[model samples]
Target chain A: MEISSKLLEKAVAEMSQLPGIGKRTALRLVLHLLRQPVSQTDSLAQALQELRTRIRHCRECHNISDSDLCEICNSSRRDRSLVCVVEDIRDVMAIENTGHFRGLYHVLGGKISPMEGVGPQDLTIASLVEKVRGGEVRELIFALSATMEGDTTNFYIYRQLEGLPVTLSTIARGVPVGDELEYADEVTLGRSILQRIPFEGSLNR
Target chain B: MEISSKLLEKAVAEMSQLPGIGKRTALRLVLHLLRQPVSQTDSLAQALQELRTRIRHCRECHNISDSDLCEICNSSRRDRSLVCVVEDIRDVMAIENTGHFRGLYHVLGGKISPMEGVGPQDLTIASLVEKVRGGEVRELIFALSATMEGDTTNFYIYRQLEGLPVTLSTIARGVPVGDELEYADEVTLGRSILQRIPFEGSLNR
Candidate 1:
């Protein structure tokens, strides 16, 4: 009954530290990995090892990149004047997947959250201000989560760029696609109510 | 949009191979790893690499172990004469968690399935027969899945040990605790019917 083995215990402990994984789940994941072919596990190991060593933050906008500048920042085909500001590199990828937005991106690394002891100085706000000060940017879209902390961070950024030429805006929040009103959470319902729009063609009809 | 980054793509692709995970989940896991401190990702990579290089199969029962013998096999307190035959190491863990079983185990790796081309020769059944014939074992318990393939494999093994003096039996099957009949699937219902137990007391009384 006792897991006396050092290697197995160590692997389980490591897996338990991952998000949403417990000790039992960690054991299952470790044992599953142990059963798979050695080559498949080796590939995962190599990928994880290279994730930190090979990847770097884009020098201009702090997006994840293997080179000095990220692919989005380096592309001349993108709308250089319009930049979408996000909380992390993952948001950058999500925006990139929507082929409609042909604009540049600025990754803020994280949002300002006083409860978590995170402040504007701890993030890439200075770099963003510097980018805005350069006078090439037109519109700055804030595509952050609709949490209170996210809003606080967005407001802080907006105040920091006061009198700057960039027009700041945020993504609309409402019921998600394929979801009905019955399942929508209270906060989403409230926000959708507050931001309700007038029907356009129906007014004329 | 195309996944322009090779390293990110590689990491996501490798992660997607895990059970119950798809491309989107792989991307989420990769992005989560990317956001973490470099040391955390390094630890995961090191653990994954060590899992392959450090863990080895037990020579006796084919269970995963860091040494020549597994923890269960090496324990002196367990009943060595009562061997519980299982389909994989997962079943061994499940029975061990109950803390009722005080016996040894033999992992058959997989069940006999002619549809997928797996046969008796591909299993550890021959070694099991040899272990029983060695005169140390007294009883051989079949603790396999309740699937048709599992039943077929159990019958095939029973035929192999027909002349042996060892006792053979299976675990009980019926309605699970805290489960409703409405949620029960057809296979479980059929199994419950076939393996029904006699009434301990008259419900009418």
Candidate 2:
């Protein structure tokens, strides 16, 4: 749409460059900023600039961090011998929120998606393999999403650490915790039944 | 959501401060920015700051502008004697896109909403009344949205200009051009029937 002010139009254009945000939404958001005090916009701009320019990725896990190492990697409490592989730090946050997993994380940056031109080489898979070769990690758990890309990345990584002493396993594929059995998707239900755990093991959890 | 980096968390918090964006969406958007080149985030921050700090409002109509006067108010082609009163510049953009109205606009910034603690004094109502008293505008068209707050703002303005020589009118309310009559809301359909125009006049348009 044609905007009256060139500066406003530029701001809207920049805002809409983000995924899922349209020109109309960008205009609304920009107008909202205009209505708010200038300090709000200033802080927002400052924060974004600081994040993009000053942010560092953990040298070990590749998760976004304030310093060379992320808190998880720096923490002595977390199990260094157990690694959970994920697509990005978002998955790290999700799994961390669960308060169940005590393992350290291996952020892959993203999955191998041929459609998007992302390859296994684009991720931190090489470092993960090296870590496994270093003999500290006893088990590597694949915690990526249940998408085709996630499966491909898992298989690719599994092949990379082929015949290594370290064990490789994937997170369970099943109907979610709160979902009804009948209402679950066919493949998910089928997988749930096929991967059913022992009765005693389920009760223990 | 628990973010790894302080800078990342700050960025997400700032992004979620925007209207309609939740914490999850904010994290996703912020991560998307991190994946892109630093230049993109830099430009976005620059554009927002420029818009917020340098943008001006038209002295006459209070519409956002690059200079003292907006394009519509500065142009000689638009009818200065005919003014369309709208809630904000978004409405101006919508009407301008239609290319039907040749009149100038008076942006009220926002409507009167008691629920939000917004009153007439919070908007540009005083300037609008003064504009009417200036004796330049011969007709005022109310182009505000069909909402209780819009009606209140319109009525409040109408009262302010009561007994003035200028004429006041509201845009037509009926079934939208492409909408089916059978599916229209009851009040809208009832109003459409009650305000039926001359069949030949409709054909001429």
Two-chain DockQ for each candidate model: 0.48, 0.88
| Residue pairs with backbone atoms closer than 3 Å in model 1 (clashes) | none
Query: Model 2, which residues run further than 4 Å from truth?
Result: A201-205, B201-205
Using Cα atoms with residue i matched to residue i, what is each candidate's TM-score against the true structure?
0.87, 0.95
lDDT of 1 by residue, B75-150 (tens): 9999989999999877887888788899999999999999999999999999999998888889989999988999
Clashing pairs in 2: none
iRMSD in angstroms, per model: 2.3, 0.7
lDDT of 2 at B20: 99
Question: What TM-score results for chain B in every one of the models?
Answer: 0.89, 0.94
Whole-structure CA lDDT of model 1: 0.84
Question: What part of the reference interface contacts, as a 0 to 1 fraction, does candidate 1 reproduce?
Answer: 0.59
